[model samples]
Target: MNALYHCISKYHSIPSGAWDALCKTLTKVEIPRNSFLVKEGMVCNNLYFLEKGCLRGYYNLDGKEVTYWFGFEDNFVTSFYSFISRKPSVENIQALEDSALWSISFEALNQLFDAHKDLERLVRIINEQYYIRLEERFMAMQFKTARERYEQLIENSPHILHRISLGQTASYLGISQETLSRIRSQG
Candidate 1:
């Protein structure tokens, strides 16, 4: 939980008492590699703080998995729409490695928001960051060529290549596995 505390403090400093209260609500969970934290058509009832390892959010489109985002250690992970709207999610969140996570249920989180206003501000800031990243990915897919996208991924997240399969990376870049192989060969 130290990692979670440190990450949260970077965004907003919660009073010690509020922090304790928040800690009490957290449930530690372990997800094995290739296991799902949330699956399509399920309501995401908990928001997770990844303590260790990796996870990816993807959509199953006509039987193909299209990964859009990856979450690393010290990051928050959730199906934002389903978590907030109380609706079933259209995407899935799967652990890419054996992972340790701390989760807080939506009900407990709301109670904390009502009690600790600062926590609410912290969540708002986190949401804004997520939106900014989403916009950047959207723009890149709209304007960048496959090679350019692969280069940008190498520049921004080279470690991802070591952590995930090349096929998954290719999916995230919206390119064919063969195209990614060709790009790698050119290097």
Candidate 2:
């Protein structure tokens, strides 16, 4: 809960009453390794704050899963497009380890947001942060080599190498396992 509080406060301040109300909507969950929080073609109605463990978000392309993002403790993960559009998600978010999460449904969150303008502003700021991250990722992919991307990812999330398989790490970096191994050796 403190993690969530800090994450929100990083962007904007919320009234104490609104924060308390938002906390009431959250439900803590334990998810086992290899389980999906959201599967392809299913609507992602909940947003999750990962309190412990790791998760990966991937797209299924021609029967192969291509990893794009990873989430660890103190981070949030959701199929944002699916949640916002009320449509089936195209990607899968799965637990990479046994995980602890606090989740709130879209309906619950929207209701809270409606009742608290300050909370809505906080959420807007949060969305802007995510958008900025997306843009940075796009720019990195456009201009950075695979090794450079790997280095940047490590600099950003140093624990990732310990939490993921070489294949998963390689996929996330859009490189092969051999390439990742080579990069790892060099680093």
What is each predicted model's overall lDDT from 0 to 1? 0.95, 0.90
**Residue-pair clashes per candidate, as listed?**
0, 0
Error of 2 at 185 (Å): 2.5
Per residue, candidate 1 scores C-alpha lDDT tens digits across 1-187 of: 8999899988888899899999999999999999999999999999999999999999988889999999999889999999999999999999999999999999999999999998889899988988999999999999999999999999999999999998999999999899999999999
Q: Give the candidate number with the greatest lDDT.
A: 1
lDDT of each residue in 1-187, candidate 2, tens digit only: 7888887787888889998998999999999999999999999999898998899999988887899889888787899999999999999999999999999999999999889999889778878888898899889888999989998988998788888898988988888999988988996
- Give the poorly placed runs of model 2, Cα more than 4 Å off: none
Give all TM-scores, in the order shown: 0.97, 0.95
